[model samples]
Target: MPARLFAVVFGVLLTPSFLLGQVGGDRLIARISRDDANGDGKLTEAEFTGPRRLFETLDGDGDGVLVIEEAAARLAKVRSNVAKAIENRSEEMGNQSQREAIRRRLQETRGGARARVEPDHENIRYGDHERHVFDVYLAETEADEPAPCMIWIHGGGFRRGDKSEGGLFARSFTENGIHYVTLNYRLSQHAIAPACFEDCARALQTIRYNADKWNIDKTRIAIGGGSAGAGLSQWIAFTPDRADPLADDPVLRESTRVSGIILLNAQTSYDYRWIQEHVPGEAWKGDGLQQLFGYDVDRLDEISDAKFELIEECSPLNHLTADDPPMMLFYRRSSDPEIAEKNAMDGIHHPIFGTELKKKADQLGVGCEVFSVENENDMRVYNQRWTMAVDFLKRQFESVQ
Candidate 1:
């Protein structure tokens, strides 16, 4: 489990009173209540299948994996489906308030969509069990040269998300001349932090190992993700030095650095200053965060130091040296006015807190661009973000050529 995630879950379980006033508290509680098994009102393996199915759907490549692009594509589909459902349900109910609520839910559902994707399925080993898998959206593009590749990681706070959710974005990337791969990683209560990261790492290794066959530029691979997955993607770029030397598998031994990165509304740090002031409780327990770090707050200092080591090794911001690859970021408007106002009040310009990071990149002479999606509609935001990202990748790919 990741330490940051551990903090989140710890906050959830230990502070029931505090969570009553949380922004999305009721919805989260309902999800947890319905999904938990054993009448324990907590998540168990049995209760986690809903999220896992979603994850499997996102890993469209049938390579027994999930990547960022595929994950985004899958979520986009869910969003689209939810939106369509709401619209239909709204018309049936014929109530302005009810219809508006459903419409808003649908709008939030497809918060990330722009491309189209078709996934292939397969099975992979999970311990002694064989589980389903998925791969990227490839619609038979016959290129003379290997296509530039991207592997997307989905964000659901490492609990509930899928690569296929990146449907629209994945299709857009592939159409723009980049081969996209999406996959599912082990999630909380099913597996923990390193489990998901290891899954993502393995998927990339599989692609690189089979690059010749897949016609991909093994050297030009890029990684991107939204929210929590974005943090994981950043981990891959930041922790290049921690590449295992004695690992038996070639992919495990390989470095995780990519030629570039695309981040959207990522939670960049876990210093606990802001969350402590605002959330100040333990109602977030049994959430995906605890599963990632493998520890609670009591052991956090030791874990924090250890994770800081990992952070130094894995944070892209730390590796913002001249040799680092070009990076692009997108920030969408926060749904909550208070959160949005806090951002403005604090001078925290970008939703992902990339303003300072961009400045650092400029000083280092590394190329970095930042874009903000002004719209609240998921489709429009997805369209704008993908356009900007595709343009950036075109330039990067052309520069290398």
Candidate 2:
């Protein structure tokens, strides 16, 4: 083997515990055992094919021969050392921003796998804006009865996400006899608060308008999203029904009432003052705040009363009431105040948002459940939360029926 190829092969063989896993380790060991030229369970220097330096390293006891058992033990030690080095480096270098970036990349990769289940209807326009289009995945149900629907909106702090992010939830919901719809709305770059909110509202109304054709249960619809999208879902769910029965536009006549809502790492309020008061940090100072509200960030201290009214109006918490749909909120961050106050992103998606919302929901006798991960790195718990969200939505639909 060429020096590079030999290095690659040896690298794979040495790190089998980490790179190839247990099954792969077995196969590699078998391959190495085949090189036992003298029918012994060990390889002498004459039989070893890799560099002398590597053989010496694997020998572990300065022995002239490489015993398979000893080599396996050495590999395990190497794997442990590599893992510790990575863990230490991560602890030293991992900041919220870098972690968030890694999370986005992972989501993007998983989002690609989700994209495999193509939409039944793609780019169906609900309004004049280009971003007003939505993709629908009709339920795979056999019954004639209309199926409950779930609409997902993407989150990027109102600036950077795509409706395709909804692909993550498409299969799970559709497989359970529920219709799934994912949509794109105007971002901060396109327009501010009410525009994105109205765009999503219009999309919901449009879906309701085509209820019969899509075999949708208009009354059993639910809305959900993460971060900015979660905030939008709450805005739609908590607000009074926006149906204009006598409107000339038939779509506008459709009710925007949903039976439930799922919020993932959601921000219940967008008002800077409310955020500061509840979140214990400068969450209001996050990027895109100015663009989101169409106000100058530097002049926030002197913001006019009219602009403050707009802020309050856009906040979902302000609109929540006893009559609003039941809600399920999930947060990846811990509820510890000190941790939440450590960074802008943490403060922005703090579990306290859910706690505060649940308190009010309890006061008003509304159904609200908040789940937070004590260990944010545990993906199993993160994934389980989403499973619980789907179950919660199904239960909500069942209750209403």
Question: How many backbone clashes does every candidate have?
Answer: 65, 0
lDDT of 2 by residue, 49-125 (tens): 75555554464322234677757765665445433433443444455553343333333433322323678999999
Q: After superposition, how far is residue 382 of candidate 2 from its true place, in Å?
A: 2.7
Put down candidate 1 lDDT per residue, 1-401, tens digits, no spaces: 34443333323222233432333434434454555344432232334444453333333322222333334455446535543654465454555565355544443444423324465333322222121243655524675678788777777666666666666467567657788777667776576555666666666766666677668877778888876677677667655534577988665665666778888766454333333333323312323454555656556656666764543443346655767778887765333334433322112213445655677779988787765544446446544767778777777777776
> Lowest summed-lDDT stretch of 10 residues in model 1?
123-132
**Reference-based lDDT, each prediction:** 0.55, 0.75
Q: RMSD for each model, in Å, please?
A: 12.9, 16.8
Error of 1 at 125 (Å): 7.2
TM value for model 2: 0.72
* Top TM-score hit: 2
Top lDDT model: 2
